[model samples]
Target: MTIKIAQISCGTEYSGIQSEIENAAATVGGKMVYPDVSYEEITRAVDDFGFDPVSPQLKLMIARAKALADGHYDADAVFIASCFRCAEGALVRNEVRRYLQEHARLPVVTYSFTERLKAAQLLTRMEALVTIVAKKELLARERQVGLTAGIDSGSSTTKAMILRDNEIIGKSWTPTGEVIGSAQEVLDEALEEAGVKFNDLEGIGVTGYGRFLIGRKLDANLIQEELTTNSKGAVWLADRQRGEATIIDIGGMDNKAITVRDGIPDNFTMGGICAGASGRFLEMVSKRLRVEITELGALADKGDWSKVNMNSYCSVFGIQDLVTSLAAGHTIEDVAAAACHSVAEQVYEQQLQEIDVRRPIIQVGGTSLISGLVTAVGEMVGSEPIVPENSQYIGAAGGALLSSGFLEGQ
Candidate 1:
């Protein structure tokens, strides 16, 4: 039976749950709906779940969890995915089971956000990790796929990638802490890297933290939601027919999860105005370790991680967890893999089963570029995480493809 599911997470600051749920629903031939809420709001909402004049924070958290299942996500079932259930989870669990006993209407199946995360971390240690589809697959997806340039100018860097024929022709990443100057320079650099002059390209789409401010003057102003661009960019060369899959784009600022099912956008969600479970958090941690972001991926390839002791909800605490692990003689690879697991756990806890969705989830964005992330997420979806060749180009490619109205044509 095709289930209509509402997938929710308690306090995920990232984007994995929603889109992954959408993908999960699609894979299982289910229908999914997304009710958007920021992670902070979710965490706070749990506070009120036990609104029967509950006492103490822990009891209140439990009451709130129960109340939430009773009130907000009144679907057939509630998917309780939280890294740490806290007192809130216990209460939520009690309410769900109680409701089931009294009403006996629908069943509530709980998936541990932490377990999914650990599985992802474990997969990072595999010696024969699945290699991403080769470049030829990307190029073969579409003939004469329009070439476009996506430039993400950030506080510390300007990144531009060229997408053509479903393949990334070239990319340019240069430090431009100042968004203004690098905006102009990176365009030229990206065009050069693609080996194509500006006039030859069909479109140029811009995104990211500095996308709007920078891309306007270039007369190349195709502004898109960072999440959609990120997710679609990641799916540019996937095997889903008619683009039937959800895209999970977890980035520096927040997570943006999009549900593109039945070859149409069913729903999309984003974290609002918070740096919780963000790419910036990872970037900060990487900086603290004096490591490059690219290097972090290769580091996760080593099979050494066994324990990750993350106790904090915030990234700062997460970094501290990393520090503690290092002090305990954890290898760099283990630490990085654990970091990815922590992130996945946070995301899963916040967004899973609030809406029931499908599988074959396509995980994308800078974090998705991490080997550990893809592996961890794959286990979360009960399937291999789909990362396209030129995984980095998914956003750019999606923007370009969407700009051409490719879906409309198909």
Candidate 2:
């Protein structure tokens, strides 16, 4: 039942992303193919997305994704793994993003490099179920539906969830500074809320930037792809009210564009290497403006007509633009809206590049509920993006669902 999966890793020559991916793939007993350079790949991908797929780096990445997809040719199915920069965690990241979006092979493209690293690790550990969370649900009819939990140790947040009967019964989130201690604290809190003992759980799953550190310490299973986790969570929340979703997840250091169809995750995209126009960048700018982190959305709504000149979306250099705009007398609201524009643009482009933007959309993550962002993204995306309740919990919820019997114990 091993499906063929293709992984296209870009800027692999410079960053450790390729090495990490390779190591993960090897561990999972999965095969991979990468182009010597990005150019040979542009021609192979179909022009289906109205994209030329001609950017050398993109072609290189596509070549990798194609390779993974090709591996599935003889298998029952195929999954595509498109990866961006490796974790050199430095300035050269611009080169990677520029190379990726030069001609924009996929209209709405997202690399989510950091998120993918965790995904790669999970793929290596449980490659079979990495992209197949939905697949496992078919087993729900046979296996006993047991209590399962997902301990998510995010860079700035610690979260725990309990999924019983495909319902998220109890969930908790706290800022994370110390990994091991924070994980234990949150887990105990979540279990207490659920009124369940640790022994009641069948398996534990973990994800997020801090996953490797805390996940390894635990003996349970793990799933890769924040994309998968988030998408699944979005579906769960949206389904609670029979609402549809086109999720925009803007975290402290990153951003994502996820399209969910009928309460089921269909496709998604991610931002550049670091968090410019993403969460981290937005937070930094918001802090400099002395604005409360949660109030950014409302501030954007009140922004004046002054268009900002800060074009650099890189979080590192974005400060200069913010300052320059302010020196010119732009109000804080005006400046923040411009930042909102930058991020909203990224999300809009990602979803449109893949599918027609006809479906109802939902925005998740920290920025999902932003006041001004919704209208801005709606106007740009051509449809209002709804922010579902508990949007932040989508990914963890998905992980919890996997442990819940709705999938395997029906």
**Could you estimate the TM-score for every candidate?**
0.59, 0.69
C-alpha RMSD between model 1 and the true structure: 12.8
Q: What value of lDDT does candidate 1 attain over all alpha carbons?
A: 0.54
TM-score of 2: 0.69
- Write one digit per residue (lDDT tens) for candidate 2, span 295-400: 9888988884248876545666778888888999899989888877876666555434433343667677656767776767777877777677777666566566
The candidate 1 region of ten consecutive residues with least summed lDDT is 124-133
RMSD value for candidate 2: 7.4
Question: In candidate 2, how many clashes are counted?
Answer: 23
10 residues in a row with least lDDT, candidate 2: 88-97
User: Per-residue lDDT tens digits of candidate 1, residues 214-281?
Assistant: 66766663655354455445555564535457666666656655555433333344442334466677
On lDDT, the candidate that comes out on top is 2
All candidates' lDDT scores?
0.54, 0.58
